[model samples]
Target: MNETHSPAFQREQLLAQDAATSNFNYEEFRMQLQNRISHLEKRARQLQKAMWISAGVLILCFPAVLVIEGFRLTEIPWVLPLWSGIGMLSLFLAAVFSGIYSSRYRPLLKRAQYDLQLSMITELQAQVAEINRKLAER
Candidate 1:
């Protein structure tokens, strides 16, 4: 049980020790995976909030610009429709971009969550194998 033992040796020793216990602490592993999932979920929420906030701010700015150009609207009635059209177009574009951006990252975030779960499962399997090996040794 030297501290400087290689990982394989440590794993072997762990396996040997685990045989005597005949019990695996699965709850700890489950809790760790749950925490990781929670963290990823929070990150997704934050990304969504930021995307919507940015789109809302951009959309709001369009109306402010129209108000600023109100004087020109009176001098040229066509200016009103033109500005309104431009504002609406910009809002539409913002929504499209945000939707695309969110859609893109969402899959990646989900993949990361899936990978984390997979890793935990793999670790559990390794522990189980070690335990079985130790039992066989007896």
Candidate 2:
């Protein structure tokens, strides 16, 4: 059975492959690095938006429940009140979950950014080394 690689593992492998190249393909490496950086930036923005949305909804929960309870819509059955409470609870939980997920996404983005920086620095060093070699040959 073939072992399945996780996405993170796969990304690391790709970066390693690029970093390990003895002959640098400047265009391809730059494009790949730029693409990865842009992708991570876009993802981070989207997740940040989601986090803010979730936070807004979460913050509104108390007031929403208060407003609903204050309405005095029904008297005897109490079903609406019960359902409203449950609904609020569910919404709150969902918001919390979204926020938590967004938080996780942030670290992933940060790590990707760090990797991008490292790759850039490595490429720069490689270029410098190549230049030094040529200078020595002259």
Candidate 3:
């Protein structure tokens, strides 16, 4: 006479519990993946912007150097070296940022957005097929 003692009732209870847990886990996992992808995208963008800014600095350096030399501003001992140092530093920063963005963050962001999602979907499909098979067996 007890519903709790019935197989149907027990199966329903287990299924309800599983659905609740799976839904929660899926949402949390999806949010985490989205956050990670967002962070990667932000970093990639920042690196790209920085590389462009450095390029701008390097570009402007030439004219500034020319102006300094034209105006005979290099008469001071430190003036030329200062501009040279700035130019060199900007060039180095641009190269480094470009390399990091192209080689590291950009590739990683692409993988995370596309390849990783595809792999996860494949895995989830396999898990679903297994679950269906088990249910059929039951």
Across 36-101, the per-residue lDDT of candidate 1 in tens digits comes to: 888877776776666676567657766766675765554776765765676676677667656765
lDDT of 3 at 99: 90
lDDT of each: 0.72, 0.70, 0.88
How far does residue 61 in candidate 1 sit from its true spot (Å)? 1.7
Residue 73 Cα positional deviation in candidate 2, in Å, after optimal superposition: 3.4
Q: lDDT value for candidate 2? A: 0.70
lDDT per residue as tens, model 2, 1-138: 333477777776777787556357878989999999889777767767765665566566557656656775445377567756755765776676667666666566556578789999999999999999999999
| Residue pair clashes in candidate 1 | none
- How do the predictions measure up, each by TM-score? 0.39, 0.44, 0.59
Instruction: In angstroms, give how far residue 13 of model 1 lies from its true place.
Output: 18
Identify the superior model by lDDT, candidate 2 or candidate 3: 3
Q: Sorted on lDDT, highest at the top, how do the candidates line up? A: 3, 1, 2
Model 2 stretches with alpha carbons more than 4 Å out: 1-22, 74-138
lDDT of 3 by residue, 44-130 (tens): 888889999999999999889779978999899999889989899999999999998888876754545787889999999999999
Using lDDT as the measure, the top candidate is 3
Where does candidate 2 clash, by residue pair? none
Report the C-alpha displacement of residue 37, candidate 2, in angstroms: 0.9
